[model samples]
Target: MTHEITDELQGIKVLVTGGAGFIGSNLCEFLLNNNAIVHCLDNFATGHRENISSFLNHPNFTLFTGDIRNLTDCKNAVSSMDYVLHQAALGSVPRSINDPITTNEVNVSGFLNMLTATRDEGVKRFVYAASSSTYGDSTTLPKEEDIIGKPLSPYAITKYVNELYANIFHKVYGVDTIGLRYFNVFGRKQDPNGAYAAVIPKFVKQLIDHQSPVINGDGSFSRDFTYIDNVIEMNVKAMLSIHPDAANNVYNVAYGERTTLIELLGILKEELAQYDTAIKDIEIQFGPERVGDVPHSLASIDKAKSLLGYAPVFDIKKGLQASVDWYWEHLK
Candidate 1:
């Protein structure tokens, strides 16, 4: 669903970093549909060309093949933009654990470069893709913005650093900034064939192939699996929000509910079974629990709703059905 002020985005100049990846591509499409001049800066390091191929020729869409780790690239991308949606970063806790140096360079150093550029360029607002991983070891049932535990992974550390930098930029440099702490977001363009692919898309692909999907632990661990549309709505609102308290703050972007892995797997089977009945018969295998993984994650969206007028339209079941439909058509 479109935000109330989405029409305000018309004629707006916006830059979406990592705009060729799943979430960033979705943002690029939505912003373009609303008549925004969208510049996409992605290194193609993790993002795919196929994701933005449909929009490559859109009159309002411009693609800049660049890396955020490079200061010059970051400055060029943010130049003359009304708003900056910084979504570029190295994700995956396991990947970070394996290679902390690269993660820090991309997530932390790159983030600082973007912040510095946005501040210097005088972009109206800077909204970024923060992670729920920043919540880290906290056992809080519904994660609030202020309550956070020590980071459990290098990736979490990097994301947290982003929030700190954003806050500092606003305080020290008068930069308008907002950080969206995204939970486990999933949707159509999400890659399902990577070593560090999100669990939902990855599992759906395995089940579609009639292979058993592996679950770490006993499948009791859960997360606040956010949908892409919800995320888009949040981004738009954060970019356009005029509420005094909305800027220079962090907000949790989630569905405000939790779903266990077992429950998620069950729903996936049911949705995919409509297209291929054999998916229901595929067994689920259990493996050792992943390191740097928390047992459960739930978000408190009260802050976003009150501050940015944020409302999530799609819940898990509906979102899963939509995702399954896309994957079934594309993957088959």
Candidate 2:
């Protein structure tokens, strides 16, 4: 039914929670483009209707506008799926800090509901969005799958809990799953507006509008900002993979290159300048370091690479180009 990974998901019924968000929307599109039937669930808390409006009429697509924090919604969404890509958690470190309780409800409790449903349904494999934040306070560069540090914020703890619960589910309930520790992902369908918007899109929007973008903490802190296409590829591979050694494991999904935020801003400005050189005038304001944020985050993707045969198609430069062009087209 699907195109690219038809060999893996032909006739498979998949459930993608938070399917209306940026990453989820792209994932839904990828699945439909490949021929898999996708059931998308989102409360529109952060997702936009226009994101999935294009697919409402598709025969293979179904929409459930419900909060993942609601256990009933989680149960209903996973009822008839072969694989569950649980991507519905509340994001943003700032957002979590603002309302850690709400973040806990959606990210932790909501995640357990999905995991329970996955176990109850006995799905072949469940793959969910793990975050680079799980690396937490680790001083090590190029974070590996096994090494980790104490979580700095509620959001980090929640994502880290996803892995913990998944492991427990495997040992206690025999539910096999995969957790993808996504690095900073940016691309098309990413929202550029709102208080909690990601760095790339937010900065791109500001530059497009000739507004000065804020650089948190001198921008010396860098991250392994991954592209959306790479994240999508990892999800696809995770679902299709039948590797015995890869099941119930967490893999870092990234391009393995560290770029500072200052450097990232330069690229965003340069890329936006392609459409309008006036963007070059966009200045940056350095502010106090954000609370509950890591100084740097870079992932060692060898686990995903050697096992899942994952090969990233875009690095930061190419990724920023795609993301900038997309925002310029849609938001601007």
Candidate 3:
């Protein structure tokens, strides 16, 4: 899945905020594999030390134990970096709903701190993890970049604010930026034990443990579940994009397809069944719908394709199989 811009990443200094979390850790690994000098900044508020332990001793990797809320830490992390992959944010709508103040402090105020620090450091470009939740109350299928609705949760509000801040930073200070509105991303290293754990990993863990997984609704809710490799490709492309029109823009990073929750669970069960046939018999429980959850989500990746020559190589099934294999080895 290496892009044509692979040569540009070699020996480049890259900072990955939240570099100990799922997506962040994966980004760090990809960048390091491509011979980038990787600096990972994390406070471990949500990220796990074990997630990054394997790479701590890597010659090309440096770990910065710091919180994004502190301007000093943000400044320290951004200093002397060729690019900033800002993935540090308090995710999950329910988590935000439970503690909007903390979410705002980290996702909004912390984001501002990173922006200022990156601007001050004279980084080449700032590529960040945005969210499909930014689509908010919009009912449109295959969500386009230009059309968005009111944010239904504090988390969404913070992500939307990030886009605003990035735009202003680019316009006011000439700091190049790109925001990737990630769809429901799932893959290896995604935490499966947290209250805010995503569906794929959470259910995989439950099924592995022989526990019946619970669904929030009737299991018809769908999302454009994106894989980690696809996301890494987008980050790389965004960092290397030389097109005049690509800078300071937001693009949907997804596979351009959707899957219902029931179908998702079926796939998970089937995949896990390959390891333990009993997984096929596990029943699923239903719960009340979660607050701030959208009924369905799909993204249009055309903007990324046109602007950055992005082509996602993994769909849900392939990604799920890879994830299942990783969990089978790691979870045991």
User: CA lDDT, every prediction?
Assistant: 0.94, 0.89, 0.94
Q: Quote the lDDT for 216 in model 3.
A: 97
Worst 10 residues of 3 by lDDT: 1-10
Candidate 3's C-alpha runs over 4 A off are: 1-6
- What is candidate 3's lDDT per residue for 1-332, written digit by digit as tens? 33444577889999999999999998888888778999999999999999888889999999999999999999988889999999999999999999999999999999999999999999999999999999999999889999999999999999999999999999999999999999999899998988889888899999999999999999999999999889999999999889989999999999999999999999999999999999999999999999999999999999999999999999999999999999999897
TM-scores across all candidates?
0.98, 0.97, 0.98
lDDT of 1 by residue, 1-332 (tens): 44544568889999999999999999999998889999999999889999999999999999999999999998888889999999999999999999999999999999999999998899999999999999999998899999999999999999999999998898899999999999999998999987899999999999999999999999999999999999999999999999988899999999998999999999999999999898888999999999999999999999999999998998999899999999999999
Cα lDDT over the full model 2: 0.89
Q: Give per-residue CA lDDT, model 2, range 1-332, as digits (tens).
A: 11266666667899999999999999998898878999999999998889898989999999988887778888888888999998898999999999999999999999998999889988888899999899888899889999999999999998999899999999999998999998988888888889999888888878877889988899999989988889889998898887879889999999999999999988987888889998887778999999988998888888999899998889899888877777888875
TM-score of candidate 3 versus the correct structure, residues matched by position: 0.98
Question: lDDT (0-100) at residue 273 of candidate 2?
Answer: 85
Weakest ten-residue segment in model 1 by summed lDDT: 1-10
Error of 3 at 221 (Å): 0.8
